[model samples]
Structure formats: C-alpha cells, structure tokens
Target: MKLIGVLLFSACVVIATAVQQKDSELTAYKESFSPLNYLNRYKDAAAVRQYMGLVETGKMLSRDDIFSLFNPCHRQQMIALFETLYGATDFDTFFKTAVWARDRTNPRQFLYAFSVAILHREDCRGIKLPPQYEITPHVFLTTDVVRRAYQAKMTRTPTVIPMKFTGSVNNPEQRVAYFGEDIGLNSHHAHWHMDFPFWWKQDYGAVKDRKGELFFYMHHQAVARFDAERLSNDLPVVQPLEWDSPIVEGFAPGASYENGQEFPMRPDNMQFADLPFLTVQDMKLYEGRIRDAVSSGFVRTADGRLVSLNSTYGINCLGEVVESSTHSVNPVYYGQLHNDGHVLLSKVTDPKQRYGVPPGVMEHFETATRDPAFFRLHKHVDNLFKLHKDLLPPYDLSELEFPGVRVEAVKVLGTCKASTPNQLITYFDESHIDLGNAVDTSTYKEMVDIKAVVSRLNHEPFKYVITVNSKRSANAIVRIYLGPKYNWFGQKVSLDVSRWGFIELDRFPVKHTVITRNSDQSTVTIPEPKSYPEMMSEVQRAMRGEVEFTYDSHYRHCGLPHRLLLPKGKPEGMDFKLYVVITDFDKDVVSSDVTVDELNHISSLGYCGVLDGKIPDGRPMGFPFDRRIPNEEQFFTPNMKVLDLVIKNVRQKPME
Candidate 1:
C-alpha cells in the first residue's frame, strides 16, 4: 500500500510539472509574438507563402493542416475544406488539435476560427482562458474596431473623429445608424453568427442543439430590439426591404480598413442591382417558394418529398431551409434566401465587380450593422418568419400558466442617486481603449498612450426583487423580459404585435428559498470588465502568497456585453413594460449532468441555446411570448405581472 501511494504521488507531481511547463511555454510565445500584432499584420498580406508551399507538394492536408495556414483571405475556403475532410471525426480531438495548430499560425483567420472553436467546444466548458485571449475586449469592441485601432496607432492618426453627416441631421432615419453603428451591438451580432454558424459540421452531427430555432429567435430578437430603439428615437418602425423599391436611406459607415482603404458609401436613393450569383428574379422565386410552403403547409425536400410545416419541428425545419444551413432538409429547392439576400445587397453597388469596387459593409458580419440597409434586410427576413408564426395556434391557458406558483410583486432598484423605483437609467459614457499592446512601443514612444475614445450607452446597475408565493418549496425558474409599451406613433401596441418584441433580460432557476437577484449577478449580462490595474493588483496579491489565483467561472465567452444591458432611451425617458413570470422549475428543467459551473458558463443561453446540453427550459425558446396570447387583453393574470418601467437618458456634462 505504501509503495502504491508513493507511485501515485510521483505521478501527480509529474502531471503538475507538465502543466506548468506548458503554461510557461505559452507565456513565452505570447511575449515573443503577440497574437493581436500578428492578426493585424497578416490580415494585409496577400498570401501565406509557407502555406502555399505546403499545398504545392500535392499531399492532401488534414483538417488540422488547414488551420496552420496564415492568411485571412483563405479562411472561408479552408474552413469549408476542413468540414469536408474531417466532419466525421471526433469533435473533441478535432477541436484540441485545431487549437494547438492555431498557436503556431500568425493570421487573424486562424485565431478567429480557433477562438470560435474554443467557445463551442463541448468538452472545454468552464475552462479558463488566458488573460490575453479573454473574450471581454472582443465582446465590448469587435475585431474590426480592434484592427482599426491598431492601424490608427501604427499610422500615427487619430483613432476617432466626427465625420460630416451625409444626410440631413434632422432626418429621423439617421437615428438607426447611431444604434446600429455601435461597436458592442455589432460585435454581439457577429459573435452570434460565430456561435451558431450556418455551415459548421455539415457531415458531422449537429454541433449545436437547436441551430435553426436559434437562427430564427436571435435575429427575430435583434429586429425587435432595433424597433425598440427606433421608436425611442421617435422614428417610424423599419420597413421591410422590397427588392424592387429604391433604397432611399443610404448609409456611409465612415469606416476604413487596416490598409487605410475606405469603404464605399452608398449615395442617397441608390438602387440595388442584380448580382452575378443572385438576381432579383431568383430572390422573387425563392420568396415565392417559401411563401408557398408556409401557405400550403408543406415544402418539397431535396429528394423530391413533401415535408409538413405544421408541427413544432416543422417551423425549425423551415427555419433551417430558409436560413439555408448545411443541415437544411433541402437546400436545392428551398434555397438560401436570408444569406443570399445579404450577399446580393452587399454587392448592390458593384454587383459585377467591374469598377474594382469591393462588396459593401453588408457583405461581412463584422461590418453588416454599420450599414442601415442591414436593418431593412433583416426586417424583411423577420416578416417572413412572422408570416409562418402567424399561422400557428395561440398558446392555450395550460401552456401559459404555471401550477401553484404566482408572482406576487416585482420591482427594480437602481444604483444611481436620482433613480426611482421601477426606473432604469441609460447614459452616454466614453471608454478609452489602449492600442499600445498591439503596437511597437520601441519605435514610437509617443504612441504608447494612444487610445480610442468610444462613446456608448451605459446603464446604472439595478436589482430585481420579486415576491413569489409558492405552496411548496420546489424550485422555480424566473423569466424576465422587457419591451416598449408604445409603438411608432406613441400609441399602445396590441399584445399580439408586442409579444414578439419582448427582449429576454434573464432566465435562471431559483430555489423558492432565494428570490431576489441583483442585475450584476445576472448570468445573461456579460461579466464586468476587469481593469488592468485590478488584474495587476490580483497578480501582486497572488505573488505575495496573500491570495490564491482565481477564475471567474461566471464569465463566459458567449454572452451579451453587460455594458449594453439597457438600450438608449429618450432624454425625457421612454415608457416600457417589464414582465416577470415564474414557472414550475420541474417542468422547465431539463435532465442533465451539467455542473453548476457548466450551467453558469452558458452565458448566451437566452440568445443562443446551451452548447451541447438540452436547452435549459422545457418550453420553446421563447415560451409565453413566442405564441400569441389566447386573449390579448388577458395576458396579465395572477401568474404573470406587467409592470411599468421608464428608462431615462442622462447626458454627461462636459469637463470645464
């Protein structure tokens, strides 16, 4: 027994030593060649010479081989090839190998792909990421913004400057750009695509649990939020993009590439042209087919079989077909309407590429929201989804109600000095992002302090105190949602129209024993940013043996940034409705062995379902609000309560 114990101790020491050595090597590599600097540099290179040489040998490269190529332009082709070659392999082995290979590559494409793989890795849940690769910065400011900041510093130019307005300042449509152009919001949209990619694991089993349903819900929620922001700005709701109609609300992104090339700005009243890949007639045909499927209650599959669209799975199947993911039942007949629409609109200015004009901002996820046309395009997509949803039956009372549970009362408590009960406050705050780490300080000492000032919406932290009356001590899941009470004309919107507009604030299971929740404690919101100073202090404390190294298990790579918790409201305050619902946890809970840490790691659950586990809730993604209320006037009953809330926009005073 003593000999075996000694051997076990020796094995443990060896494993610990190996882990320490690996960490040391990673730190050394980061210090020698920062990934951020490499991403900035290689994105401009025309080709990766090393990778091209490997390709010339005529030896087939493995999926891992594709990750070693250091060229941003070749990423899409490489990813496509990777899926084709290794789709049937074990996902865990494929992911770890890709991550290992990513460390050796110096391109932004490899890093982006690796980062996404890490986030989606089912086995790597709750694993702590290195501070440099932490996703907070990426969530707060997108990859494009980071690249632009690094470029600005390298070129000795100002990071941000006010651009002259192309359209009349008084035009109400101009407000969409302000919210749409926000870096954080756009970053969230881009990350959602990465989280639930349309083309991942084509031959492999489904990577995510409900990719098609998430595709429908995430975009639907985005359009709803966009409408909320539009109404807050006193602008009319966004109109769907009709292919034949002229796009009058032209957008100038005021964006530049790392190479200092500026993106083309669409002129006022610019008309879309037929693209080489997709034409107006093709779009009309696709739309017609999808509408026919919705109206006729069936769609033709790839193998020429009619599939019903009436069941719950039917909508999901239809979503996959319309979004045209690789998992689509039939891509040939259904076609990729949503994605193709974005592609066609992106090339509206240079459909044939005759003038050497690159695709517009709509072409890339990172720059899509920078264009106002994106909202119009998505509004059209949402309208199509709504058309299908309208055909579904409304939720019955049994589906909407919870047994023996009641939300007695609920109120929000704000942290600001003048904050009132049930009132949330949004204000503009400037954040200075340092680019010194990505730039060479030795060459230009003056550029070390170079920073980009970004003005964005911020809200004071608030807490939710809900009083629930339960007969038993069973667990209950609390769902909180917010939506604008008034429509574009300042008139109260019908419950039928407003049901789809509700934005999920948070969803968590609470022991009937514990009821109150602080906003800072929300699992949906992005974890608070850890400042450099605070991180250094923690490091010092650990070095002095005063405290052990710690990781915030609550902070997950997939979540909405906490900085954008609240939308920007009007100066006087915007009238909104906060709805709270308490449902029986037994019914809502899915049977899973996922640990508490793993559960917390699913920060994007409200928007993007859990990675590998069953979606936490038993009900549909958007439960009560997903379908129409049996009776619109009877939405607020004993189990659910709608409370009036106001979000006031506070302007910061200029420094003297």
Candidate 2:
C-alpha cells in the first residue's frame, strides 16, 4: 500500500507539471489570438506573408482570392481552411493551426471561420470564445469610445463609459433601434450562424437535423419578434423591400472598422443598380422560379427529379433551397436568393468600391440588424416561406383537438410585490462590458480593465399560472405565444394578420391540472451572458476538471437574450394577447438518446436546435400556427385558450 501510494503521488505531480506547462503556453498564445489583431494594430506582417506563401505554394487560394465571404470562391476557401482546423488531432495542434490561420486569413473571414471551427471541433468544445464585441469593439462600440479606451490605456487611467442607443427620436424607424442594435441580440444572431453555417456539409460527420427548416424557423421568429417591437413603438409593420424601387429609409450605423474605416452609409431613395454579376433582373428571375416551385407543389432537384412539396420534408426542402445552403435541391436553377439579396443591399452605396469605402452594415451578420433595412429584407424573405405555408392544408379538427385536456385560464404573476396580475412589466437596464480585451496592451506590463455600460430594454421576472382541468392523468406538450391585440391601424387584430405577429414564449411538457412556469425557465431564450472575466474563470475551471462542462451548456449562449424576450411595452400598459396550446406528448418526436433530465436543463430547443442532435419537438417548428387558419371559431379547441393582457413599462432610474 505504501509503494502504491508513493507511485500515485509521483505520477500526479508529473501530470500536474505537464498541465501547468501547457496552460502557460496557451496563455501566451492568446496574446496573438486577440481578435483586435485583425485590425492590423498588432498584426505581424512578415508572419502573414510567410504563411500565405506556403499556402499558395500548395496550390490553394492566394491571399487576393479570399477577401470577402460574400464571394462564392472566398466562401469555399474558408470551408477548406475550416476543415483543416477541424482535422487537427489534438487541442495543441488545433491551437497552433488557429494561430497560423488567424494571422493570414482576412479579418472579416477570420471571424466566421474561427468561430465555426470552434463550435464544430471536438477539441475546442467547452472552450469559451471571447464575445465578438470584445474581439472587434470597433464594430459594436462607437469609434469615439474605442479611441478613448486606447487613450485611457496609454495614460494608465481606466474608466467606465456609458453607451447610449444610436439613433435619435427624429427618425420614426429608430424607435426600435435599441432592440435591433442590442449587443446581446446581435451576438445571438452571429452565434446562430456559427452553429448552422451555410457551408456545412454532411461529410463533416455531424448532421444538422432539419438544417433547412431550422434556417427558415429561426429567421421567421426574428422577423415576427421585430414586428412586435414595431407595434410597441407605435410604428407600422415592416414593409418588404422591392427589387425595382428605390429604398426610402437611409441608415448610418455609426460603427467603424479597426483601421479607422467608417461603414458606408446608404442615402435616402438610393437606387438598386446592376452590379458586374448580379442584377435586379436576376433577383426577379430567382424570385419567380421560387414562387413557381411553391405554386406547383414540387421543386426540381439538381438531377432533374421533381420532389413533392407536400410531404413531411417539404418545408425543410424549401428552407434549404431558399437559404441556398449546400443542401439545396438545385443551386443552379434556384440560385442564391437570400445571400445575393444581402450582397445587393450591402453595396448599394458603393457598388463598385470605386470610392474606396467599406460596404454597409448589411454585408456582415453581426452588424446587419443595426440597420432598419435588415428587417424589411427579412420580411420579404419570410413572405417566400409564408407562400408555401399558405398552401398547406389546415390542421383538421381531429389533429387540433386534445380530447382529455382543457385549459381553464391563464395569468401572469410579476416578481415585484406591488405588481399587478396578468400584466408583464418592462424597463430599461444598464450593464457594463469589459473593453480591456479590445485594446492591444501588449507593450504594457500591467493589466488594466476598461469598461463600457450600455443601456437596454429589460423586463422584470414573471411566472405563468396556467389552470388546467384534466379528465385523467396524461402527458402533453404546452406551448405559449404572445402578440399585439390591435393591428397597425388600431383595429382589433384578426386571426390571419395576428398570426404572423405572434412570437413563441415557451414550450414544455405537463402532466398535471396546475402548471407554474418561471420566465427564467423559458425554452425560447437562454440566460443573460456572463461577464468577460466570469466566462474566462469558468472556462479555466472546466479545463482543470474542477467542474462539469458540456457542449450543450456552451451552446446556451447562442439563444435570444432572456432580458429582451418581451418587447418594450407602453408606460400606460399596451394591450397584448397570450395564446396557450397543449398537444399530445406521445406524438412529439424527441430523440431517444436525449433524456428528459438532460433537456430539463437550460435548452433553447425552440429557437436554436439541439447541437449534434434532433429538435425536441416533432411537429413542424410552429405547429398549429405554422399553417393558415381556416376558421377562427373552429380553430379554438378545448385544449387551447387565449387571454387578454397588458405589458407595462414600469419606469425606473438607470441601473448604474
């Protein structure tokens, strides 16, 4: 026993020493890994040149061939690089490859490629990525803030600065700018793209179950949520962008690149002209073909087979084709409608780049939503999916009915003692983000913290008390949704129009007569993101085996920010409707490998699909609601109920 104990102690000491050495090496490597290096401030040009020469000698794309991911060839080049990174045998090798790729890849492309690689690679799992805003503060924070942070770091005096919402009250569209320009909201968008990258292939070993359908549902939800915000701000719903007409709303993002380059602005009434490759006529052609496919109830595959659009996989197929992912049935005939639309809108101000200006915010996913045009563009995209859905057969009375269950009533209870029942509350809150990582302080020996506080819309915690009368003990899936009570014209919203405006609130399983659900436990959103320092500390502990870590938990950061789940309601209380539906749980097709306990943990299985697994819900993503309503009276079954309510913005002082 003594000999065994001695051997074990010596072995542990050796292993600990090796782990300490590797950890030290990683800390050093992170200095070069700083996303700010992409700005060229701390870039090593000789290292980049050497790396590019080696890659070119191997017959891969030259540096010039890969600049913007908007280009098809550039996207392909990035995929190749990502595959190389994923193929690494261990974490050490992956780290080395990432360091090499980081310096040579274009700054814009590096952001996507590196993030996607981190999400897909097993060795990189559980490793927390620094938030993109911290990586490129220039894009999220105003240039003035970034410049001041640098100035402060040089002077050895750090300070906290407050970041106000971008636009003024003059522009009516700017009413919801706070929602669109939110740091957490934009991070959610960027992170979702990383999970379901358009370039992903099945050969990569991880099949994104219903990748196409998920692509459709996620964006659809975003557009619907945006419409709800618009109605809250007393603005009309977003109008679809027209291909032939001039864009009326102008947008200046008030953001810049690290090289001191301001994002180009689009003037009011800017015309859409033909670029060298894509033209307005081409866009129209793509739209016409897509419409024809949906109308005919079939889409032609690449090999010339007509696939029916009426099957269980119909929506999924259409999603892939519309998003133009690698899973698209016919890329040549269908064309890249969604992607090219972004390209056309992005370059309207500087189509040729003859003025030597960067493209507008529309060009990148991270910064895209800051502009009003993004919602308009997605509204058009949603209509395409809606066209297909409009033709689907309405849910029969049998399918809609939950025979043994009836929802008697539903009410929301706020966390505050003075709060009223059935009334959800919203307010403005401020949170600080560390900008210490944004500034390159390699030359300085001492570490200094630079912080910025951002004001954003938030809501008080609330719970749902759902009264149910069940004839017998049985299981069912409960779904909750919220929407405006009136339309843009102040008329009572009809079922048809209100259908598109409803955003899903929560989805869960129930087996009793009474159900209580907390807002923090919502399935549609994850918890608010942790601070930069907090995330770093947690990741280090996970690496040292001090606590449990899983890829699913890591993915929690990719969902909608819990704080922004409810739109900013009127101070006097805005009228809204809450719709609850209970469906047979036996019919819900969840993967066998996923245990109920595993799912009980934080899961955004609705907005963001399960990583490396199937979506928990068996029904089409927006079941019962995905299709058009045949008759409003007949649509309300015993198992479903709608409650009238109001969401009030309880005014309070700034959080800071």
lDDT of 2 by residue, 1-656 (tens): 33333332222222212220122223445454532233232223343344445465654444332245677766766766666566555555555556555545655565566667767766444445656676657678876778778877988887887776676788888889888899888888878878888777887787788888888888899998888888888888888898987787988777777556788778788888787789889989998999999999999999999999986569999999988888899999999899888888888987776787766788777888888888888888889999999898988898899888899988898887677898888998888888875576566646677898898889988899999988977777889999899988889966876887788999887767799999988888977766656655655565566755444334554788898889888888899999999987766646555444555653787788876666767788888888989689889999999998899887783232
Give the alpha carbon lDDT tens digit for every residue of 1-656 in model 1: 33333332222222212221123222422334322223222321222333433344433233223221212345554563233223213433343334333434333344444445445544333333322212223223334565765577678776662222234576667665656766556666766776676776543444577778888877787777788788878887778898888887877665543233455677667676887667888888888999999888888888888988876656677778888787788887778888887777766777787886655677666667766788888888878777877787877777678767778888898866666998888777776554434333345446334455667667788888888887777776778889998887778978888888888788877775437787866655666444333454555565566766554433454556676667777889999999888777666666655333445446657876765557766666677787766577766656787899998877972221
What's the TM-score of each model vs. the native? 0.79, 0.88
Judged by whole-model lDDT over C-alpha atoms, candidate 2 comes out at: 0.75
Q: Report the lDDT of model 1 for residue 21.
A: 19
The worst-scoring run of ten residues by lDDT in candidate 1 lies at: 12-21
Clashing pairs in 2: none
Q: lDDT (0-100) at residue 600 of candidate 2? A: 61
**TM match of model 2 to true structure:** 0.88
TM-score of candidate 1 to 2 decimals: 0.79
Give candidate 2 regions above 4 Å deviation. 1-67, 537-554, 590-595, 653-656
Per the 3 Å backbone cut-off, how many clashing residue pairs does candidate 2 have? Answer: 0
Total clashing pairs for each candidate: 0, 0
